[model samples]
Target: MKLSYYLLCFFLVFTSCKKTKTDLTKITAKTIAIDSTITSAAAIDSMVAPYKEKLAAEMQEILSYTAKDLVKNDGDMQSSLGNLMADMTFDMANPIFKEITNKSIDFALFNYGGIRATIPKGNITKASAFKLMPFENELVVVELTGKKINELIHYFIKNKKAHPLSKSISLIINDNKYDLKIHGDTFDETKNYTVLTSDYLQSGGDKMVFFKDPVKLTKLDYKVRDAIIHYLKKVDTIQTTIDNRVILK
Candidate 1:
């Protein structure tokens, strides 16, 4: 009888201590409306005011002046703004690439869609640079084979858009055949050329797959917008023109 009583107690304690699995039977959610009912926190506002004021002033500071509006669609195959962008990239990135690899960049090519905004005929500021290129793309030089260079030329010819090309290349499209010149020399299929472009394009962006799997790729670790800002700061006046870098004749 005593044994039976102890067993009953032990069974009761074991059953009580045993863990039971929980299964979610149902879930309910509540929606909270966020309207004008919320008020700005005074402490947070005070903390952020000083930084905002400094940034506003810096953005408005004049960097340079332009007598004529620099736009990307002002010409048939080239524009003032596109030339400036491509030239600036070549000018800035070539030095860095030379320092690292001891080789000069053959040319620069950037897409028309990459130019975000135009420089109006007035004072240019830091805000202008930001508006023109809000992306954080870095410059890279890719050593492409002569075949790849031909492919690049073909791509440009097919697009027929005013893609920014530097003065180093003169591409004249005629009928189904095209005449190409690099650095004032005729395009040679036996030589490899180093081309300057952004990291985005190097990764095969915009269907420019030729940039991938190059002979060599050297990153300049320089942002395109910073180059523009640097160029703007160094010049009192910004002057650019549509040249014969590309002729669709």
Candidate 2:
């Protein structure tokens, strides 16, 4: 009787294990066209209407005016939009950075791809600023030695993209040679310079690894977007141009 009972229990366990196993089946998908005529549900629209109203109000708030369009371009040098962004980032953050560390930043550097949208000529709104810089990248200062600064220049020459640089520096790329000026002075190989940039680039965003291993790192606990917004609010007009700051031959 005991042997018969044990045999029945073993059979029950085996059946349970088999029941848990699933068989793989080949399934095919049928392509379906989207319904272009579909409308939003009334209930869903009603629920979202208030939030949409608030968003519209905030986005429409005028911050400043632009006399001309500022756009990001793939030129050999920097674009108007790039210059504006880099210069504003430095201008707004310089005081805060100086207050914190008692050292003013030399210049600001940013990627051209960072400007997501162009500013139309006329009123500049909060929405436009947000469109330009959608990321919440914070402001950071990296203190680099003269050697690393040279690397920064070389990287700029190799990558001929219109990476935004503040007017505090000047760069002229003539064929294989480059002339770099920091703070209106010629590039000094013995001096250490403090550079202001987004935290994203400080950690090697856009493959800017020259910013790594800095002599010092300072976080102003401020967002670059906020700095832009602040500058726009204070300035009545936004003016930036592509001049000798970045030259390519």
Candidate 3:
């Protein structure tokens, strides 16, 4: 009887240990599967392979094309590329502002940081724009008082960097003073004006607190880079020139 009791106790303990091991194995297997799902280089590569191939092919085509007309017109590839982006800045902002706000915007401000590179002359392709503006930044409209608009201009000029302006904006910079003109009209401090800019600037990325204090803000679903790409596709023929919208001298 004693031997039989001992045997039964041993059998119970053995079974419990086996069950615990099985549970642990299952938990470890599940953890490994979850980790593999996200970190698997092969899976990621498979998903991105097609896009990579397409971009490579497009870039190759652009490189092969000669810019006979552009060269004859004394146009460089980088200038043309800058014009493409600058033009898109206006094209995308004007119509969208009319559609959403029903009020025409005074001008659009694009951050200098947003422009990655000059579009090379010749065959400008979608892939080239991607390389130029890699970030997936979207367009945003911020309504600010005329005072804030002057402040924004001062910030841009003080930095001495290039920022895209959609409409006619002139800044007369003197010793610690700036005279700003928008569309041939003097800026009114009491009057409200809508300015189209990127979400990045609105978020105070470039020390632009004016947008942060905007009376109204709207975000568009369109990415700025993607907008440029779409614009390029629509207008196959591109002219490269310096608009000098942001003049240093």
Model 2 C-alpha lDDT per residue in residues 1-249, reported as the tens digit of each score? 999999999999998878565787898989977696778899999999999999999999999998887887734578888988999989999999889888889998888778899999999999998998999999999999999988988888888788899999888888868888888889998999999998899999999999987999999999989999999999998878877788776
**TM-scores for every predicted model:** 0.87, 0.84, 0.68
Model 2, TM vs. native: 0.84
How much lDDT does each candidate structure score?
Answer: 0.91, 0.89, 0.67
Q: In candidate 1, what residue range of length 10 has the lowest lDDT sum? A: 169-178
Better of 1 and 3 by lDDT: 1
Worst 10 residues of 3 by lDDT: 69-78
Query: Given candidate 2, what's the lDDT at residue 180?
Result: 89
Q: After superposition, how far is residue 95 of candidate 1 from its true place, in Å?
A: 2.1
* Candidate 2 residue pairs in backbone clash: none
Better of 2 and 3 by lDDT: 2
Evaluated with lDDT, which candidate comes out highest? 1
- After best superposition, candidate 1 residue 226: deviation in angstroms? 0.8
- Tell me which of candidates 1 and 2 scores higher on lDDT: 1
On the 0 to 100 scale, the lDDT of residue 61 in model 1 is 89
Give one digit per residue, the lDDT tens place, for model 3 in 1-249: 999999999999998878443343443334344654566578889999999998778765432222532211122112334444556766766687788778777777766666676555578766667777888788888889877887887776666655566536655666557676777787777888878778888998777777897989877677887677667666656654555444443
Candidate 3 residue-pair clash tally:
3
